[model samples]
Target: MTTPQTPGTWTRARAWLQTHPRAWDATLATAVLACMIVGSFADPGHHGGPKWGTRTPDAPSLTLMVLGAAALVLRRARPMTVLAATGALSLVELVTGDPRTPVAMCAVVALFTVAAHTDRTTTWRVALPTMTVLTAAGMLAGPLPWYAQENIAVFAWTGMAAAAGDAVRSRRDFVQAIRERAERAERTREEEARRRVAEERLRIARDLHDVVAHHIALVNVQAGVAAHVMDKRPDQAKEALAHVREASRSALNELRATVGLLRQTGDPEAPTEPAPGLHRLDELVDTFRHAGLTVEVARADHGTKLPAAVDLAAYRVIQEALTNVQKHAGSEAKAEVSVVRVGPGLEVTVLDDGPGHEGAPQDGGGHGLLGMRERVTALGGSCSAGPRPAGGFRVHAILPVQNHARQATAAEGTGNRV
Candidate 1:
């Protein structure tokens, strides 16, 4: 915790400094000028330290030193200009005075600014030449030995300034990279969330399509039957009306359950019952049978347990296929549905023995076949719907059950642990 806290605090401080660069530069200028002024008054010749006798510079030389130091306040904005101006001022001081003030401090500050703002290639290019020229000029013109402390001090200060500035630049770049990575991760998370929402909405749409198409078709047929025989056969009409009522009621219940899922948090709770799957196939077939269509179901999977997703998808495929048969094929048609387990996959095939396409009803843009295909494909399965060679329409889907089941089990285990 301490380690993480330390870096966070340091990053905040660096950000503040970057935002107020002018103020920080002004502070640097003030410190550099103060050091030059105080050093000028100290006795350089005294081997005994702590002697501060003033060496009063001429008016013109004092003015130039003050201007050079003050110019450092603009170092961050115009580093090259400040460096050139301060370097020229320091050369002037070295040639005119016997014991010059340390105006080179301003040049050192400007060099640091340049190094921090620019790249290493530019820093090396500028630093090497500035160091050589400033040191040579001081040594050649001053009334001191070539190896004097003042001349060596100038080189040391300038070199340290360049190194320190480069380090600061590197740290700034590192922090910027970390910030970019965090933002990119945030963007990726948002995209994944949107993708999941889209998939869930598609699934819900498929469910609604299956429910509405199947139940409404049955109600329409039974209502037609009820109206057709109302005058002569009143008893048969009453039975047809009863079937209509039952179909409509089932439609309303399924619709209520589906729509409840889309309500807001403040709304009433939705039905908590699990969605329909293979166990409801018999009831589904019975509804079609009551509506005067023959639906045969043959299962050879031998009670093999299925994952929730696979089961739901299988149920939806059968429901949609049967609904298509009821709508397209005539009332005299028959549908056969078979679910078989072959190795690691489950195959569901629905076939209807109706008249060929010339006699079948035109679909007029239905979503049943497309929704079944989407559901099967999403589960990494294959589905095909077409007219059979000698008979009516056929829809076949092969779903890889074993892999999906194991994946769901693993996910459940991980969720339980969490």
Candidate 2:
């Protein structure tokens, strides 16, 4: 809300004046000096007053006024120079004893210049002594009585103006500094927010890379086998083609879920657990059975309470192991899936009793091992998947309990919470 400017008067004039570069400040002093010079030319006793002042014809006082105005203009660029010019003109007024009031006006302008440009210590070094000398000398050095109240009034008002101008400049500098610091802090916050968003994008990209690369590679290999064996082994080729179709569909679905995370709007209808968790272990085991692989599930931690993330990770580990069995393990391979509750953590173990495929190349250039490692680390868990010593493959994950996972991440200086 803007405060209303006073209607058609001094306030509007002042607002416009303030917009100029130090013009309002110098304008008042210039106008007062001009009035003083004009007064010096007025009839001395025109109003029957003892001395109406400014009655003297144009001469040296006019020159002094011109010098004072020029000093006002140069105040900001060269404060000391302006002060010296005005002071010299004031001394001349003291000697001539003409243009009596305007000399005091010039001294006041000089004091303001010193206060606004120089520090307070410097202002004291120059202004205080100059004011004392000017006030004392202007009264005593002239025909005026030493006890004249008019001279004392001049000294008090001029000192007050200088002090006020210095305070205003000081306040403006301080407020400007605070505004700059606030702007910098706000920019820093925005940069930090953007960095966090970029990290999340990287994480989802890795998930898509792992899922698509592994599944599509299997589909490619199966399609090649099906095409090669189509005439001689029609039934075997049809089965391989069916597996390719299933793998491709699964890959498409996983890709969709990963891409969904990029949307800005949170899905109100989205499920809390997007991936199939360990609760679907039976369905997963049956899928492997239908894919012509023997699978056994040993549940040591069935029905145990677990966080959604831990359950999801455990389920994905088993799912990936079985999928690898179908793709890489020869048709007669047997796989074992185990879930156990260990000390402060859940351990998921997958064992395959068939030759595990090694050196599998990925389409997007990331092996499933690398993908699993990233997810496990992000969740503050440990995962190791490799070929077993006895001619098979083993994938094991030990994920902390909900409370332990939160504590572990905090201890590691990661602000991400469970």
Candidate 3:
């Protein structure tokens, strides 16, 4: 078994230091000053091994070391200024001190800060000059020989610091870019999910409207007829009541199917009836005929098998159009429905020879015409509904016969060629 561990004192302290940059820089400067002061007392010229406390740095050397270390306190906020100040102090110590002090250590740290904060071009421009001037001063004017190890050490240490800082900067930039890309990708996925949800809601609303509007309109007409004729003619009233019952039953079945789309996966199974299509045009026209509206259907499309989406869109367009005509046109109105296959498309048109009504969908008071347009448009088709130039109203739609997969493949091919 594994156990989670709480943060230790050191971890907590490190986190706190990271949040307070000025304090951390001050701490670093103190440590560097301590190191420089201790190093100044060591002698490399001792007979045996190099010994500490065998020599003391002159006043000028001590002063340069203190100034260089003090400048590093503002290294992050003013990297370029710190580098210049420390470099000048190191050059002074290299030229004047008989035994050069460790003032150049502060310059190396400042150079590293500059590289980590600035771009590569700026770092390179600043670092090269600083390294050259410091190394040249140590080699040319110091009390020690030009070929001394200390002179070469300055060059090597400064180069390493600049390289290390640049590596840190590059890694940080790469990590930040990766984090931003992930966030943007997550946002895109969320937006796509929301868009799909909105589309699904609109689709369900249209389905409910189609089911309720068509069946209820028929039921309403039949009920009104049955109520009117009940006293005068019992037989005709019973027949009208039977028609109302049938219309209501059909409406209930369609409502169950439509509402079932919102059920959970483990819910009871819904009705398995196939969705109504152009194949059921006869049945659809009959219901309107029973309501006393004369409907005539003509077909020139042959027995063509359409993709499911196109078939459904065509059915819905016809259904909504007929519903509008039955509701808006007078009892003596006659309707004509035509299905024609032209070129690569199937066209459906509905015309009713009724005096145009102000309450019609063409006047923008209902969703019947709008739903038809949405259904056709979703299938990459076109739909138009308007009052006829002669009389009555007309609804026409043209739907492409291609399935989604074929259309997608053709689109991909075109994109590749382009």
> Which candidate has the top score in TM-score?
3
lDDT tens digits by residue: candidate 1, 1-418: 3554455787887788789988777777778878887877765766867467657556766777789888998887788999899988877776565666778888888888889999888887888888888888879877777777778888898899888889889899999999999999999999999999899899889989988988898888888888999998999899988988998898888888888888989999988777888988899889888888899999998998988888988998998888878878778989999999999999999999888555332356677888889999999999999889888999899999999988988999999999
Q: Which stretch of 10 consecutive residues in model 2 shows the poorest summed lDDT?
A: 358-367
Can you write out model 3's per-residue Cα lDDT over 1-418, one digit (the tens) per residue? Answer: 9899999999998899899999899889999999998888887666776698767888988888889888999999999899999998998888888776889999999999999998899888988998899899989888889998789989998999899999989999999999999999999999999999999999999989998999999998999999999999989999999999999999999899888889888899977888878888898889888888999999999888887778878888888888888888888889999999997899999999898767887575678878888888988889998888999998999999855648767988999999
Model 2: per-residue Cα lDDT over 1-418, one tens digit each? 9998656878778778878757875786678677767655554333565454445735677777777876777677788887778877776676566435456677677678778777778887887777777777768785456666546766786788678868977887889899999999999999999999887776676567656655775677678779989999999999888988887887787777776666566564332337657888897676567556799989888578777767766776777667776676677789998899887878888888786566332332545667676677777899987777887778888887867556656766755542
Candidate number that wins on TM-score, 2 or 3: 3
**Cand. 1 Cα-lDDT:** 0.85
Q: Model 3 off-target regions past 4 Å? A: 1-6, 44-49, 403-405, 408-418
Candidate 3 positional error at 245, Å: 2.3
> For this target, which candidate reaches the highest lDDT against the unseen true structure?
3
| Pairs in steric clash, model 1 | none
Clashing residue pairs, backbone N/CA/C < 3 A, model 2: 39-54, 40-54, 40-55, 41-54
Question: Candidate 2, TM-score vs. the true structure?
Answer: 0.67
**All candidates: TM-score:** 0.81, 0.67, 0.92
